[model samples]
Target: MKTSNRSCPPCRSWASRRTSRTRFSEFSPQEARNERLLTALTIDQALDARDAFAKALYSSLFAWLVARINHIVYKGSKRTSAISILDIFGFEDFKENSFEQLCINYANEHLQCYFNMHIFKLEQQEYAKEKIPWQNITYTDNQPIIHLLSKKPVGILHLLDDESNFPRATDFSFLEKCHYNHALNELYSRPRLNGPEFGVRHFAGQVWYNVEGFLDKNRDTLRTDVVDLLISSSIPVRYL
Candidate 1:
């Protein structure tokens, strides 16, 4: 199996050079604009009305080219074995407050909801083979943190929808509470390597999580930026 990590421009610009086929994610609109502005400057063009119009046209063309490549990749890929890692911005402690934090938290909570579904689907498929009473099983029976993150209408998805009654920060804190409430030790309660855990082991082949780092308990916050980036980057680390 091969693995690759994708990064934002700021991070990629600073990354160590490595010998691998480079893959660039499609640039966002702002980045396209910046690229065009730089290109115009290199051509010794003054920033004027005509220059602005030309820059806009060239930026749109550049964006279209990137998007075209992205679409071709999306449509042509036939790799049956593929895993996507997501690495968004990380979370912050109360001390580190900003719109960046809010966006990161908001995104993570929604991800938790997806994580919850993944766990449930795995469990359900396992129980089907075992003839276990699946419906009677508590969704929160094993993954408490995921359950909490996915709790009811108050879950991350609900909170992210701006039309919802809850404020963004409030919804974010609610999900963060679930994530930070427990110490990392909780993973031990569930069977990880053998016995009943093996039932779902086969189905778990495609998707697995690798988590690292720890939160500052005394500070009651997380160093979410790196972890969040990993999660958003197509590298799954939801449990941590």
Candidate 2:
């Protein structure tokens, strides 16, 4: 498979031979806006924005590579046989779990659920239906957990995105919403009402994810200034 990385303007600008920040008219409207937004950010916010941009760029590159590979493989081809390889991260429990860990664990939960339903659940139902002699097997049914993490409207991911839509939503507010919707759920818990961390009980173990940079990471935005700067042109990283 061919690989290509979609680099940001700021990165490209830094590598340019002759770098300078010209007038606003020299840059696109989005680039000017990006610069303004970036200049206004606190040191912490700027750092978070940087990471978010990196993740976004990686996601875009991965998507482009997948699309390109698919196009090459499937263009005018009749499918007779196909093979797919699945490789994904496993459940994680670190001292400080964050947005990435939360998502990874959620995926693991779904995989486990799929196994339980097919191997443990469906098999038993079929056996009982056939009236065959068998032992009643008890498995850890993770339906409740699957519902808690991904159920409609109130799922954690859904709630995060919903809060992200609001211009003023903060991590604390997101946490509040999470706890508010899942107060009765045994699988979810919070040490404090407005804490930076929330705990979830997964099939493997319990994990607490910090919500500090969750919103910014979820945004995956690149300021216009960044695009303009990274392009083959002058971009002012520091004001004169």
Candidate 3:
């Protein structure tokens, strides 16, 4: 098992870090409030840890519940195979920062990178096996999403690097040139009253949707040809 040595909010290490009385001795309102939240979280972590420890002592309690449920559903099936379905919430947007959030984000990123590398390799292998000309494959399969997100100098992260303009000025047109151009455009084109379909792109390692306002707002230097590609609803912006 590959384990992370990083701290987690609901884990033992974080609980130990806040095990001092001086942590709550602050008198200032903001400091007091922060301390209270941290203390509450620490207590929650301790209690959760205690409960987990207690589970081993009372293992039969869980076993009995599982047995009862299985008995009710199984109906004396000769061969029973238990399959666990795990659909962990892939990436999280949290209200507060914690070790769990960091771990989840790290795992999500790691999985994404791993999957991208595999996909790239798989595509290359399949192309090789079929003896397909490398240059002819649509850009969609060739460039995985991670390549875009992790691109240097002109990538999305690069454009959003300024703290003052964190979620502001961005140009996503470069994505059209991505190896996954068709997949990228399909995602960027649609509005999202849809469900989990949006995140499917993220699993592929690319940010599907981007802000056109941000792109248009600062397009002159970042992307000169953007004005020509601008498509509006009412007014037709002729593409020359």
Candidate 4:
């Protein structure tokens, strides 16, 4: 297999070359308007955005490499049987779980659901297809919990994103919406006295998440000024 490399434009701007010290008040009205259009991220916010982008880039590359390797090995194989190993992060619990932990746990739930489908549902499917008589084994199916997390319009992630878009939104409001929309869901709950927190009964176990910075964490906006500055700087961080 051949990999292609692409060249990116070099950064040439002073803002991109040096640490940002520009004050918001110093910006012209037009610059301020552009900043608003880009969500006017602070220095810390810009660094966080870059770090997130780097992580996502590496993860995508890893997945692509795995798939490519599998394709290469399977293309000319005489034997049809093969064994594969996958390593994924386990469910996490902390003194204060946040959005990232929620995502990690949700991924674990999805993987568990996939395993159940293959072990239980698929086995029965194969038996029926082969006309073999076999007793059906009962197993817990986590479709409802998956739906609660991923269902369109009413999913927890969608609700969080909706709340993140509002300037006046707070963690409390986000929790309130979660409770209102998913009050009847067995997997979802909120403590009567706990401040701005919610619980999800994941397949692995129950985990409570603090919603203190959920809205801000979900707001992964990069200011246009920052982007332009980076693109114009002589820094090594070039976008291809």
| lDDT of the candidates, in the order given | 0.34, 0.72, 0.38, 0.72
After superposition, candidate 4 runs with Cα above 4 Å error: 1-16, 19-87
**Tens-digit lDDT track of model 4 for 37-121:** 3235566655666665445445545555555566668867554333387768788989899999988888888888989999999
Residue pair clashes in candidate 2? 9-229, 9-230, 10-230, 30-224, 31-224, 31-225, 34-224, 34-225
Which ranges in model 2 have alpha carbons more than 4 Å from their true place? 1-40, 71-83, 128-132, 192-194, 228-240
Off by over 4 Å in 1: 1-66, 71-85, 129-240
| RMSD vs true structure, all candidates | 18.2, 7.0, 21.4, 6.5
Question: Which is the winner by TM-score between candidate 1 and candidate 3?
Answer: 3
Candidate 1 vs candidate 2: the TM-score winner is 2
* Model 3 quality (TM-score): 0.28
Clash pairs of candidate 4?
Answer: 11-233, 11-234, 12-232, 12-233, 13-232, 13-233
Which lDDT tens digits does candidate 3 get at residues 3-94? 43321111221122222323322211224644733323355334443443344324533444445456567767663444254655467544
Worst 10 residues of 2 by lDDT: 19-28
User: Which wins on TM-score, candidate 2 or candidate 4?
Assistant: 2
Worst 10 residues of 4 by lDDT: 5-14
Residues 111-199, candidate 2, lDDT per residue (tens digit)? 89889999998999999999999998899988788888888999998999998899999998999999899988899988765568888
